[model samples]
Target: MGRWLVLGGTRFLSRAVAAEALARGHEVVCAARGESGAVPEGAALVVVDRDVPGGLDALRGERFDAVVDVARMSYAWVRDALDALAPTAAHWTFVSTVSVYADAAALGQGVDGPLVPRRESGDGATDPEVYGGLKVAGEQAVREAAGDRALVVRAGLICGPGDGSDRFGYWPARFARGGRAVVPDAADQPAQIVDVRDLAAWIVAAGERGLTGTFDASGPRTTLGAVLDEVAAAVGAADLERVPVAPDVLAAAGVGPWAGPSSLPLWLPASHVGIVARDTAPAAAAGLRCRPVADTARAALEHERALGLDRERRAGLSPAEESRLLTHP
Candidate 1:
């Protein structure tokens, strides 16, 4: 078994990766501030704030076969981790985002597509305009630090259980409400999302095999209508009324695409459909296997219910907004 070091392995994709590594009998060590959540059982935890002084000092003298970094949002974070662990870690895997792509709207774009220009500085603040640029900078930092030992996985929308973003989870949770739900008019618009568990397993497998270079870690392309159908089936919302509203109308009503407050998650504009239709053949050839969309939908619904569906969500149309749109339409 390999010795693995996972940065920020307390939540979502990071947590999944740590758990998968543990399941594979690897000795896993997770370093992160224990604010968000806890790492999987059987993994050692090192509490440290990556942005503060002596944050990475906890890793000194520790040797790891592989290091999976899922929480490095800025170039500084990557640089700091490398400074502390590069000599001790043989392999480095950086979990980047598809947002690093400059033009995902271009058809057939894959991992080889153009990337957003790197940012001048590595500020960790979350700015939507510069998010892609920041990620590009982080990727570059990792590549420079680890060279051929670096593996970059450019992941698209990650769904399934423990998805706090609620982007892909919104569909199944909305369907569970069992009423008139507002959907984008573009029924055939493609959607791309990979289950978190699937992504984590693939990352671990790649590290174990000493894979290098970049890979687009997105799932097979699927359509918006097909996703709704799966959610309907999973939630037993056979009688659910899906009100397809024009994109412009929804936009005018103050509904934005993807996650964040007040946005209808996964409902991108018509021009951005290619974002979800990204070519994943390269990743597939590298052994990325995605689970069925229905399975993801069902699992998301279960998780949402466990978290209390009636509570305020990070995504999806608010009940008031949905009611207003349905009534006005």
Candidate 2:
């Protein structure tokens, strides 16, 4: 069995990776502040703050076959982790985002797509507009520290059970409610979403195989309408009414795209159509497999029900906003 070290393992993808590694009989250690949630049961938990003085001291002198970093956003964080664990870990896997690309809407853009310019300064709070650039900086840090031993996975929208983002999960949970759901007019627009489980499993497998280089980790290309259909089928919402509203109308009404409160999940502006239609052929050839959209939707619905579907969500349109859009559009 391989020895694995997982950074930021208390929630979402990091937690999933730790769980997958443990299930495969690997010796896993998760280092993070235990506030968000607990790590998977079997993995050893090491509580350490990565922001304070000697925060990474807990990882000093520890050796692992592979290290998967899921929460490094700043250049400093990546550099610090590399300094502490570079000599001990043989392989370093950095979980990056597709946001690093400057033009995801461009046709044929893959891992070689033009990346956003690196931030001028690594200090201060990361500007939301330059989030992608910051990620680029972090990627560079990993490559500089680990050299050819580094593996970068540029992930798209991550969904499925345990997703707190609510971007891809919104449709499934909305369909379960059985009512007139507000959907975008661009139904045929392609969309890409990777299940958290699938992404975690692939990362673990790749690390074990000592895979290097970068890969665009996303799911099979699908359309928003097709995804909604799958969600309806999964939830048995045969009579669900999909109110198709024009993209401009939604945008005029202040409905943001992709994620966050008061936004329509998986719906991007016209200019960013290429973001959802990203090419996943390379990642697929690299052993990145995605589960069916139906399975993802169903699992998300079940999770939402457990979490109380009526509760306020961090993403997706609120019931009142949906009502306004559906009734007035």
Candidate 3:
């Protein structure tokens, strides 16, 4: 078994990675602020604030067989991690996003696709363009610093348990509620998602094998309608009825596309459709396995049940909004 260092392993994907590493009989050490949550059982936590200069000093001189960095939206943090730990880490995996691609309208592009102009520094904005630019920069930095040992995973819509985004989980939760739910009429829009567990497992396996290269990490291309139908099948209540509302009608009714409040999550605008339809064959061939949508739906529904189905959500339409749309549409 090898020693693994996971940056920001207290929550979500990073946490999943730590858990997977531990399950694989590896010695896991997670370095983070320790505020998000606890590290996985059997893993050691080295609390460090990456936002502070020299925050990673505690981890200096501690060599690791593999290191995973899930630095989101910050180029400086990516650079700092590389400067501090890249040399001592045998394998490095940097979690990046599909938004790094320049043309959101271009379909089926792979790792070699054109990327947004890289920005080594930004004002810490969370907008899509800024976020994508920062990721592009981070990818460049990782490849430049540790190309021989680097694995850049350009992940698409990641959904499953512990997903704070609330995008894909919304469907399962909504379907399980058993009502005339308002769904987007754009059923044919491309939709691709990956289970968090699958992604984390792949990352750990790749590190063990020293997998070096960039890959578009997502599931097979499928339509939004198929995804929704699968979710409904897996978790929908007996009385669940889906009402498809036209895009224009949804817009006029002040419903947002994709995510956030009053939005039909996973329903992307035409311009942004390509991000969900990437060619993930390279990753699939490299041992990135995705679970069935029904399986993901069941897991997500369980998580939603734990969080309470009626609780206010960060994404998806509220009960009042859903009712109004159903009554008017």
Candidate 4:
């Protein structure tokens, strides 16, 4: 068994990572503010807020084989983490986002590309900024802080059990209810999403290999309609007809989904998004490849059910809606 430290251990993806590490026979330690609640059952907990004056020093005493930073965004946070961890950890995995890319709609964007630039002040850029310019800045900050030792992974929309906000899962529940597929023209546009479990596995593998540099970690690129079909098929439903509304019409209704806005027509807004390859070659070369989306989707649905996320939805649906949800059963 190896020793592993996970920062931001209470968040969605971080918790998944911690769970995976423990299952792999690793002694995992989680350090985060108790915001999302206590660390996973077996993980040793070190409650330290990132904003604290001596937060970096709090983790200085312990050593581990690797450290996964799952909640870092600011450059200052990156710098502080590396300074404390570089001395002890053999590998450093920093969870990043695809927003680092300048032009995602274009292709051939290998592991390395021109970033969208960083803002010293977090206020300058946010989740709603122009595309992912802010994430680009965060990636740069991590790169500068860890250099050769840093293993940066740029992930797409992450989804799975313990989903927290029930964003992507909203589609599956809605589809299962067998109502009009309230979709916009963007329904046929490009869409990309990564299962949290696959991402967790890949991170652990990358750490074991000591791989460095940035790499795209995402699922296969497909249209939003294709996503609906695949997920429905995964859940044993396949007779529902998906109807699309005019972009403006959808906009007027004001329903924005995780995949896109109500007006986004076809494949997840292909104009701004295009998921070709996961750019996983660097990470793949490090002995990690994303699991098949089919399997990921199936497991994600199972996990969601196990979490009882559909209880309220199940109760809310009428008998007719429930019958429509059952494509064949």
Candidate 5:
């Protein structure tokens, strides 16, 4: 194994990946603007403002065997990163999202079926609405820079320890609370979430395998309804109300987690199953193993509450509301 460098290493996914690398005895270098997340002990730092002049450029002299990029949501951001570290690493693993898939009113789309078009030009720059497109473009940038050496692992909602984003974490923690739970209209809807540790395992393995091309790193297919019940059961909670919210409500609510009352057809219908619509064929071929949703949920709640990860807090709902939700049957 060669020296490994992680961009945004102090963040959720990056830290997990860096930890795995450290455990493997690979020379690990963790870099971020500030000390945050779960930074592995004894890892070197490449501190620089992501927006400052030569901020990223400061690391030009440093070289690594591979780089795991968990940040850089925009194409320009990724471009600058590639430019700065182009000469420092051999294998580049760019963490992208499955949202790159074309808009599907209903989730059940396949990776090979039709790809979500990327906004290559126009006002597409740095727009949150264009996050998926931006990621798509960023993937292209890595391809251009590292060529066959780049591994673009497209992940779905990543959960597990240190999960900064509580999108999925909220479910388990809230479900355990046992209250009048307001869920999306379709509880049967499928939602995909990869455990942070599982994702880190694959990325490190990919580097060792020198795997290239795009691979989808996500957990096995599961539904929101099942996940909720498991979480509720885990904490010995009962009585649940299924409040349904509509997509229009989600839109009208002005964004944010609680705004929407419905799960949307994010994933529904027996044929296609639940909400996670992206294809993980590429990743499965490269070897990505996912544990059961029950295990994933259990660990998420335990870890977050015990560790109080910043990422999980980002999606945390009110404890009072949670208590109220559990009142439902």
Candidate 6:
């Protein structure tokens, strides 16, 4: 067992990483504000606010066998962490997004694909271009500091348990409700996602093995229609009926694709279709395994039920919105 430091382990992917590390007999220390939620049961939480100068001063002298940083939108955070602890860490993993790619219209590109222009300043916003730019810059920083010790995971859409996006979870939840459901007419559009648990497990394993280099981390390529079909099959109610709506009709009706309110989750326009069709062969060849979509659906449905299926969501359509689309489209 090794000593591990997780930069933001209080919630979601970071939390799962911390939990996974602890499960593997590693001593895990999670550095965060401790606001999102508690660290996993066995991991220790070291409260540190990254917005302030010297925020990581508490762990300045500490050394870890492995360090995982899931710094979402901040290049400053990435730089500061590296400056503070990169030298003392044996293995470093930086969680980045596939959006870092420069061209979303280019499908099936591997880790060798071109990246978005680097952005040194991270404003902590949700703008996709800005987000991708920051991640590109962050990846550069991690590689600079850790060199061959770095594992950069350019992740695609991540789903399954502990997911808050409510994107993929929407299908299982809505299907389980048993009614006429509105789906995008994109039968052949590419869709790819990695289950949170699987991604976390792979990250831990990579760190343990001192894996280096970049990899596109996602599930095998499949169509959006197939993904939806699997989700419906795994958890749909007996009376569930899927109603497909054309993209143009959805556009004219003011509903967006991909995520957000009144949108069909996982449905992508042509220009952005490549984002979900990335080549994941390298990641899989490096021992990254993905579970069946049906397993993911069941887990997501369970998470949805825990969060209340009827609750307002950060992504996907509201029931009334879906009903209107079903009837009017």
lDDT of 6 by residue, 106-204 (tens): 889988888889998756366898899999999999989997899999999999888878888989999999878888888899999999999999999
Local accuracy of candidate 5 as per-residue lDDT tens digits, 229-316: 6666665356654555553444454323321232221223343332265566667767888777778778877876785533324453
Please provide, for model 1 over 60-144, each residue's C-alpha lDDT reduced to its tens digit, 9 standing for 90 to 100. Answer: 7589999998754566777788889877788999998887877857766877788878874654456643777877887888888
State residue 252's C-alpha deviation in candidate 4, in Å: 4.1
lDDT of 3 by residue, 1-329 (tens): 99999998999899999999999999999999999889999999998998899889888767999999999978989999999999889999999999899889778988888888888777535578788899999999999999999999999999999888888889999898887989999889999999999999999999999999999999999999999999998999999999999999999999998899889999989999999999999999999999999998998888888888889998999999989988886
Any idea how many clashes model 3 has? 0
Better of 2 and 6 by lDDT: 6
Cα lDDT over the full model 2: 0.85
Give per-residue CA lDDT, model 4, range 182-290, as digits (tens): 5445546666677888788888777776788777887666667677667666663455556665555444444343433222222333345544433555555665555
When summed lDDT is taken over every stretch of 10 residues in candidate 1, the lowest stretch is 120-129
**What is the number of residue pairs that collide in model 5?**
26
Give the number of colliding residue pairs in candidate 2: 0
Output candidate 4 Cα RMSD: 5.0
Q: What are the RMSDs of all candidates, in order?
A: 1.5, 1.7, 1.0, 5.0, 4.6, 0.9
In candidate 5 the C-alpha lDDT for residue 239 amounts to 62
Clashes of each: 0, 0, 0, 12, 26, 0
Query: TM-scores of the models, in the given order?
Result: 0.96, 0.96, 0.98, 0.81, 0.80, 0.98
Error of 5 at 301 (Å): 1.3
